[model samples]
Target: MQAFTGSTLYAAIGGLHVGDMLVQLVFFIILLILVKKYAWGPIIGMMQKREEYVANEIEIAEQNRAEAERASKEAAEKLRQTKEDAQKIIEDAKHIGGKQEQEIIESARQEAERIKISAQEEIKTEKEKAIQALQDKVASLSVLIASKVIEKEINAEDQEKLIDEYIKEVGEER
Candidate 1:
């Protein structure tokens, strides 16, 4: 290599110089002061705003989750209530149906008894009418026979005796 020179970097391609180093240091110090005054505070404020926004979103999400849980619990309770109501309605219907069925059966039984009694009464009346008709026919026959016998005898006493005898026969038959 060549001998080291007193001109420093002026004598070499990549060597550092004192004057350039001093100017670089001064420029770096000014740039650092400008960034701290004009850029650093705003950047920090933007970062803080982003952090607050993220926190707010997390809180909202938690509230939504709690609301969803509460709604689900209410729905479960409502379902239980609806089922109970449905069961109560079914029970009431069954009870009403049973009562109605009993009433209908009782009514039918009463109607049947009334019809049976009516039929019995009609039969009794018809039997009495038949007996009366038979009695009338026998009385007429006895009167005619006694009248014919009396005509042959040609006596009032015999006619009355025959009529009494025929009447006694009719009574015996009855």
Candidate 2:
């Protein structure tokens, strides 16, 4: 090979077809412009839309989670309130039951007292009737003795026989 010089190198490079290079470069620029306008722009826009959709879905999921938590809290509060109400109802029922028991006991006591008082009154009335009957019998017996004494003067033996007969009659009537 001959030693290269700057001028010779320039002549060699210049020997290529400049018009063909210029035409290929222009076509390449046009292809790049078409790709950017028709393919690249749409692809980038689709990607942006996909990103926005994913972000929106995530936000909705977060909101749903918060709503679920709030509902759970509300349910817990309602349960607590229901428990309190149930406890209160039980307490009230117990109080009412105790009051009714006390009333029943008091009523039974009063009834017993009344029964006792009625029995005592009945016994007293029966005793009074027995005493009155005994008094009438004694009065009749005294009148009979007076009439007998007035009818005749009795000796001791006759008096004893009369007494015995009166006793037998009184026993048979009883």
Model number with the top lDDT: 2
Error of 1 at 159 (Å): 17
lDDT of 1 by residue, 72-148 (tens): 99999999999999999999999999999999999999999999999999999999998898778777876788678
Q: Please count the clashing residue pairs in each candidate, in the order shown.
A: 0, 0
lDDT of 2 by residue, 1-174 (tens): 798787676688986566788999999999999999999999999999999999999999999999999999999999999999999999999999999999999999999999999999999999998878767776787688768978999888978887887777677766
* Model 2 segments more than 4 A misplaced: 1-33, 150-174
lDDT of 1: 0.88
The local distance difference test score of each candidate is 0.88, 0.90
Name every residue pair that clashes in candidate 2. Answer: none
Number of clashing residue pairs, candidate 1: 0
User: Model 2 Cα displacement at 126 (Å)?
Assistant: 1.8
The residue-level lDDT of candidate 1 at 44 comes to: 92
